[model samples]
Target: MEKLKEVHVSRDEKEAMLSEAMGQWWLGAIGTMMKTMGPEATMKAYGPTMRQIGRDRASRFIKEKGYKGHDVMATASVIRIWEKMMGIEGQFLEASTGRVVFRNTKCPLSGTVPQARPSLEYAM
Candidate 1:
């Protein structure tokens, strides 16, 4: 048996590491789906599933983050935080009603795997 060693990771580094892992996992999942279901079918099936996942995740985030107030902006706020944590580059647009909208122009997973683009929309 070998002794285990412990290493320290800063909060920012941990976040970055987790983000990278998540991006790679997403790419791999899309690749697997595309190979198994073909690109068009994969997009059609994967898109809705991803959208639901996004909605579910946003709901969980709002609850965990203790975002009190109207539910309208809760999802948006959690999503913005999530996007930043995941290192997605984009702009936040201000709607007429003062709600901020996030749009990602560049995503690591989508850039590498074009077929994964639809997943990005759901994540937004």
Candidate 2:
């Protein structure tokens, strides 16, 4: 079950703080500070998130490193770390670019991708 608690912080402040970290993830020292802090400190530091507002300020790529599978409470802080590190207004740095490498027609790399005729161009 999701733990419900009454903390303190304004929505605007929370957004500002998280977005600030998201935009400036290169700062390793501050990130270290966050990693070392306790759970309560994390909540206090990054509180007041809204229901509708997403963790990212931009596209889906920004959330590539986000937690998959069941939503466990233990990794909430780590999720925040990833969000701050990757979530931005554009392409995500952490996610693979959905790239699939395929061999050319004559290149003997694999027997899987058969050579296609001129009529059918298979997009790998």
Candidate 3:
């Protein structure tokens, strides 16, 4: 008989692992979709769906967080927070009443799914 050593994982480590697994799953699923449906068809199908999902999520976030203002800065703040939580590295070049500008340096999904960049950009 062989003894197995106990291994402990911290919460942050578990979250990182889960996030990585999700990114892999997303890459696989998107790649499969692009292959089977073709990029144009995939974008046509996924674009609206993802936009709706984003809208729903934003609505929920606003409601849950009791967010009031709907100005550009307010929206930017929410997006910035959400991106940080998703482990997206970015710099906000400008966020004002008129506009919000963000420059993404690193994205978990982008590096792994270069072929699906068009579809991803369409979704965003």
Which has the higher lDDT value, candidate number 2 or candidate number 3? 3
Model 2 segments beyond 4 Å from truth?
1-30, 49-124
Local accuracy of candidate 1 as per-residue lDDT tens digits, 7-108 = 999999998899778878878888788878888787788778777887687677668977665554655666667667666788866643446666678765
Please report how far candidate 2 places residue 75 from its true position, in Å: 20
The TM-score values for the models, in the order shown, are 0.62, 0.19, 0.73
Whole-model Cα lDDT per candidate?
0.71, 0.38, 0.79
Writing each residue's lDDT as its tens digit, candidate 2 over 5-107 gives 9889899999989876753452343344445774345435544442113334323424664634323332333444443443311232332234322223342
Candidate 1 positional error at 124, Å: 3.7
- lDDT string for model 3 (5-53, tens) is 9899999999999988886787788889988888888878777888997
- What's the C-alpha lDDT at position 27 in model 1? 81
Q: TM-score of predicted model 1?
A: 0.62
Candidate 3, clashing residue pairs? none
Better of 1 and 2 by TM-score: 1
Best by lDDT: 3
lDDT of 1: 0.71
Better of 1 and 3 by lDDT: 3
- At residue 105, candidate 2 shows an lDDT of 34
